[model samples]
Target chain A: MGDRERRVVFVTVGTTCFDALVKAVDSEEVKQALLRKGYTDLLIQMGRGTYVPSKDSGKLNLQVDHFTFSPSIADYIREASLVISHAGSGSIFETLRLGKPLIVVVNEDLMDNHQSELAEELAERNHLFCSRPQTLQETVEAMDLDALQPYMPGEAKPVVALINKFLGFPV
Target chain B: MGLDAFAAACCAIPVLASLLAVRFAYVLCRSGLPPTRPRAAGLRCLIVLGSGGHTAEMMNIITELQKDRFTPRYYVAALTDSMSLQKAQVYEKSLIQGEGEKIIKNAQFMQIYRSREVGQSYITSIATTLLAVLHALWLIIRIRPQVIFCNGPGTCIPLCASAFLLKVLGLGWSSIFYIESIARVKKLSLSGLLLYKLRISDQFFVQWTQLQQKYPRAQYAGRLM
Candidate 1:
């Protein structure tokens, strides 16, 4: 059997905040910073990543893994050591459930700073590390995985039961 | 002379009376009397509030309002989280772009009762309506909008309350209750019945002229879209 790879960095750039990530990758300095931190490969899922099919182009020196859509996102979440995603409720909640350390980037256009609000809330609760494109490298390097441990590998049954009760169903 | 005819006539009288009363109240409120004149432009700001299919229909009116001189702002208080609020915002942004109007996608958690059981569905509909009314009231107070354009499914209650409050304060504007084309074409539900009470609007915009005739007090603004 092949040795299972641990500490895989899963990068998602298909969220509303894709532009920022794109801008970050386009910068030679950020690309070098990511390589220095040992994130050897970049998985560009969604957004502008899909449009640019050419591999080994632009300032991004790392291997480019692109996916249009995945039927089983949970499988990917389970396999990854660190999950980088847009500040979406679904992505944040799912990553926390899997016990994976999450780094979130907020989408600016969705609303007047809703992503920032969610990011701050999650950060305050010590559940995730959130950083903008400009500070992505610093935030990634300074991540405290221990802080996210309490939220990892939890079942959503309690939340489901709460919703069921609110809906007047027997929980 | 027949017994059936007499019963029909008796029922028609109260319906007609209520309709007239609503019309009279609407006219009294719509007319800018003395001190109310300054609030005329305020009244012109028609704030349409709803979620789902009703919100989609309201978007059509918002489009027309854009073409005309009257400025219309939209408040889309979504009842369900199943659909992305961003999708609704995108639609609103495209529809209201460069018009200097705003679309507020306020999220309200609602438990939709989808069972086919008639009795349970009816009760659930009533409960949901009450919750939406409460939400609408909260939004109305915050926005302080002069006129409320309600496209319903229980979100009208709070909006109506706000309109009522504004009227009392002499900042009273108009409310135009929109009876969506889809509801009339499809089967009627309990929520549709709740809408009958809100037949009173400063102006009621509907697709059909027959509805305007039935409630003679309502002005036929033609097809809103």
Candidate 2:
């Protein structure tokens, strides 16, 4: 019960196979950055990605764990000190809502380039760090945890009120 | 004399059809105004759930609403989408857990046929879409919801269209609200575009400011993720 705090960095690729992200997060460069940042543990939700972390990753002064998928990643996000995730809105918003520091890595190979649009907009607002697989290590190195502003949860109240008012329902 | 009357009948039919089309267009395109009759105490809300991201966003939106006021909620998803209905079930269970005191009740889940399968030919898709439309109409009439809520989902097209048809026919009506997906930063999804272009959605919402600027009809709702 009196254990020391375990600062964990969670990397999630969501439901898609983002092997590049899995490989990048498993690399020595990113691990070193995470270790230097005082993160004591590294966890990866590899999804359908083919890349697997080497068994010796735990010898690098960080406890490493990897899994293919979970029913829900909410608990993991809550446990994370920092989340490195894919740029999918589901993962991004979940982390933001949980008020965790996040780095969204965009998959450049995907035909739909619009995912980057949301990441860029959010990054511009200092909500999260945005990166590609190639630059993930650099993003991890340059991340400023304190610089990220806590995302104010989006409200549906106004919209609901408008709909009710339009329908002559009491708002 | 018979020949002359036959020709006159053809002209009259065309004229009547054109007039009906114009009137329908006017009804759809008119500015938003409150209904003359006040809505009933409790609203039967029909929520359309799409694929993964859309369903997640919808669940978030549903969480924000006052569950008591929106009684007898109906959730509709595509037949092929197995994950979405399961998610809905999980969400409803959580609602029961979250609010022990109120214990909001009466939520139903329904699945409709997909208009087109992946890699389906366009020629055959028309027939399936028509079937879907008929199925949607039946569902809408049976549910008779007062409000229909959907984000960017293709399945919503048939449902919203059915609701709008009811409105046009003056039989029964459900106000349609379309929220553009948050992922759509600069553009609307195909469903959003159709609803916007046809003036089918009574309230259209977009999350991004850039999208709102490009599509002025869409009100910027400030990122409802």
Candidate 3:
């Protein structure tokens, strides 16, 4: 199959239920855009959420695959061409490690706003794109996977060095 | 020099004088040489794992260690965190397979109550932390671990504190080492703040050079994972 034919978008809010993100993705506007872009497949992993797409939102009700939670989201992420995720550090890092086109959406309701801080820094470095619920649709359409900055994994595991230093050896 | 001159000179070099005074009084001392590791007998290492992200980061650190030197491991996971426990076990299994030798022989797993549960209030958190500390003291007594290790996690506060208290009481020989998470580019987490503020860890490590520059005492060992 052609790349476009197999393209899927994976949307996950990490291990917590996020109704806002799920709602935004389930809207008629997003479905129309995805249909126009030849994204025939979309998967949503909504943890502990109350909302479901139901019979509204056009074709999304017929084709979208969603679940309350999954043991591993990595498999789904690996299979997808694009990842839309909550701005959790772990999720962002995993996406970067896999070198996928990423759009980070922040849940502002979080206590620390730590996600906003992280997403802003990452966006500043051209590592990924950050969007809020209001702008997610436009951000998704504007993303160019080839133009995004690729993440380089770090070497020189500090844990071993730390352990060595404590053990009285020069790290 | 005269007594007045000597006093003035000592005050000028207060740091050096303090070190000398402490040595003279034998009031403060560094731990003796750590036990040789990776021998056929091996050293007992207790590695604490936090939930999710903390667990993932800690795994990278563990696998990076020379697996042959440490064996008969112990893992501390939060009471409800099967995720961390499973990850630890999976890493060990993969390590053993890679080496074609037993990297971890019957690694022990223990669970401790989390200091802060989901939706818990500040008051409840304080009570939980105190309870975890008590549990940690008992674990230290029973395990008598030679090396205790953790990165940044709220659950680590009680465990590391207990290890420090045990060493100070002359009741244990465990050396505690804390590594600030790589995600912590500028500031330390709550656990990092507690350990850094008190200087409890024998050697605290930061992944980024920027953090090392900010906290001169923290060793910049280069990035990991």
Candidate 4:
């Protein structure tokens, strides 16, 4: 726990990018609160998002590192103490796999409100917090890492079992 | 071997091997073997990856399955998907360092053109698919994975299809395990539907109960988030 105090707040919006999520993270209130909590660093993986903040997003006295798409986010996920991301399945599942405190920002503008379903489902399970661009500040302030549910392995057991059985292979 | 088995092997293996070298007929005559059974443990696996979520979900699978049991893993994805390649490389490295397991470094990046390309003619799409078929056949032949795992993605189709063909012919024994993406709640993706309808996938798993109930064939794995 002592070593974790220096970890970064990872904000990611997946491969295609969602400016909405990036904008939500670039708020004065969220930055001030995070600074007060002794978190001094922010890492954002913005993907192909078009909106770039002013020349510097480090105005709030927080060290910020931002990039467009990382080859592998595993290292970032591992280093993060808190993760704020778009409700892309890849980001959500990867964050959950590591049992990080995650705030999923659903891109509601998608064709079917598709991302909302997973975000809402995880929220309902108390696995992670779901936030919207409108509520980002408050949600960031209210996050409780220990309160989030830890992920369990084998959500694919029945399927894996059946595949092995059908193939007459053992697990 | 039984008389039928011997006769089929004699006629199938060499002919199919030779046909795979032919320009276009290779695509049409690829499936020339029977379904090879896998034992309880100690099997090589080829995990088909799509970019983004497909790769993420598969990496989770690699972390879950006992490493020693599923040895010499091979991950395949589209040639252009550097994200998938990078993630696979990281996962493979982590597995080796963390678990003290050795992984094969040569990954298979096949040229699987998307089935639904916007504004592209059907003929062009078919040509690309035929190309993908040969590439996948070469992969399946080389890796000869006892089981192939995939989450529903268009890129996964060609490899899974080629594996299905191997089962149809009598020369291969790779089992196709298709797991629907966690995002699918009500229905299967195009790849899932195709694999299910063709009855090629040995086991189909769905994350949501609603999806399982809708597709009687799909087994539910308690919500993989």
Please report the candidate that would top TM-score against the real structure. 2
- Using lDDT as the measure, the top candidate is 2
What lDDT tens digits, residue by residue, belong to model 2 across residues B1-225? Answer: 999999999999999888778767756755354577886667898999998778988887787777766777899999999899888888887887777734446688889998998679999999999999899999999998777889987889989888887776666766788989888987788999999998888889998889999988889867676
Residue B45's lDDT in candidate 4: 84
Q: Is candidate 1 or candidate 3 better by lDDT?
A: 3
TM-score of 2: 0.85
Clashing pairs in 3: B38-B69
Model 3 interface RMSD over true interface Cα atoms: 3.6
Q: i-RMS, every candidate?
A: 21.7, 1.6, 3.6, 3.8
TM-score for candidate 1: 0.41
DockQ values per model: 0.02, 0.59, 0.36, 0.28
**Tens-place lDDT digits, model 3, residues B105-168:** 6477889888778798998788887888888878878887767778877777878777766666
CA lDDT of every candidate: 0.52, 0.85, 0.75, 0.73
For every model in order, what is the number of clashing pairs?
3, 0, 1, 9
Candidate 4 residue runs with Cα over 4 Å from true position:
A1-9, A27-43, A55-65, A69-82, A97-100, A109-113, A132-165, A169-171, B1-44, B63-74, B86-127, B137-146, B166-173, B223-225
**Residue B137 C-alpha lDDT in model 1:** 59
Candidate 4 lDDT over A1-171, as tens digits, reads: 444547588998877658877776776777777777677788888888887754365557677778887767878999998888888887888888898889998786676466687788778878899989878878877877678888674454544455545644554
| Full candidate order by lDDT, most accurate first | 2, 3, 4, 1
Instruction: Pick the DockQ winner.
Output: 2
Residue lDDT tens for model 1, B58-161: 55554444223233344444444334244445655675555454432221222232222223577677776666666665665655554455555444545655
Per-residue error for B199 in candidate 4, Å, reads 2.6
